[model samples]
Target: MTDRQWADWHRPQQHYLIEPRYLAGGGDIRHATEFLRASGWKDRSKTGGPLVFHNPDKLVRVVFDPLAQPGGWTVEGRATADRPSWEARFGTGTPVEIIAGLTDALTQQPTAHAPNVWAPLGTHGWEARRGQHVTAVSPDKSAFVQFHQSSPGQAHWWIGARTEHGRAWDAHLSPTTPLSLVQALTTALSDPRPVMRPLGNVPPSDRIRSTSVSVTPAQLGAWQQARLTAARTAMWARSAWTAARPRNRHPATAAPRVPAGHTTGRR
Candidate 1:
């Protein structure tokens, strides 16, 4: 058999799926944070506490605190007098790309219909079990998505992806987290396109469990150039939006002063 056919025969189906950098998890925190900043989310981080960002209207907030229990990264959309609120969290071990999936949805315009999280997982041959709570596992058994009750009248969702060595990443979303954001993350996780990664960067355990495709230097360079072009296009869009909006002189948008007696360090 040719190398391509042989590799496909031995490879786990999930390996053939395209893994976008954002959904692949374990990306640099700066990518997501920078995107938010460019999209007009103000940085309101305190010197010692976790870094914080808030939307211009103050309805949405994102926090990065390595010290926080359960999750180091938290995103919250506060309820207004006429609206409800929502929250999503990610452990320090969670991928920054997965976190960005939510932020991307939050900053973008809404869609007419919600994206289907369960259907895509099912379509990809993930097994679903329903009882007190619902859980889905990828065919290769390296990934999972779950929804369960956290308390009376409280429900939450959890997603985790791992390698043979150990857990790679995980995230949590409260029941109130917007369905659109939830769909964005699920869609990313279940996409069936191959993700490009340097062979050297693949974890040893993952290499054992997945098939790696060789890409010529020229091909890799082209892929990188395409990504750069897309990023530049997004940057230009954000710049235009910023220029068009009226500058908010509200005191809330002003740079916050460090409070006395506050020392910055992970609790």
Candidate 2:
């Protein structure tokens, strides 16, 4: 990123927020700090304070705080076109343009290692990635899925889904969750034509509540059996209701009941 470009990235008029986990790793911090230092960016920080880098000739500056903990580091810049005085008083540009620029900067080969950050969402297109936790939204914004590893290394995957009607469902995948199943879910979520199964009206949070981090295969099997039983019960109830209902036939047009010798009609 150019000095001007970097400056533009942190323009006072713009704001950007990226979760800490995505950028908190030691490698990430080292890579970013080294990149900036090697690029001749001067460190004008005070004693025992967060590392601050700036180019005296340009309006760009970055601050890396190791003590920031969960918030990670904060970096800001401004383009040459942005007037610091004017922008500080009144916002110079929209967040969309600013975030787009940041995304572009991060996607570049050298900066890609810094962190994978997702911009704040408004109406559509939301995503966030932090370690084992990953969130993805469909292209049309009608569906969203959040995948995460509930256990540290038990090889378990929990998937949460939200449909157009706000219906939510979640399922636990085994250590051997098939790639085909994952791909199928992605395709189903991306495509709106075919209706997907297991995304019922009930929220997954309400239906599948696993107290433990890792769910055993036996537990999964038992849940499946219960679901099957519930489905059969529903079908039986429907059939019983149909059988109990009176037939829709007119009484006068129906066959007459014989009292004693009224079998002449039949003969």
Q: What's model 2's overall lDDT? A: 0.34
Query: What value of lDDT does candidate 1 attain over all alpha carbons?
Result: 0.63
Model 2, 19-50: lDDT tens digits are 11111112223334434444445777889887
Clash count of each predicted structure: 6, 8
Highest-lDDT candidate: 1
Best by TM-score: 1
Tens-digit lDDT track for model 1 on 1-267? 898866665554222222433234454577578777766679999888889999877989999988767647889888765446777877775656567777766766555563555766676666776555667777677777777656777678888877756777677787766666776777667666644444444444542334466555445446546644555566577568668874322111111122233222211
Which pairs of residues collide in candidate 2? 7-77, 7-78, 7-79, 8-78, 8-79, 10-76, 10-77, 11-77
Alpha-carbon TM-score of each model against the true structure: 0.66, 0.25
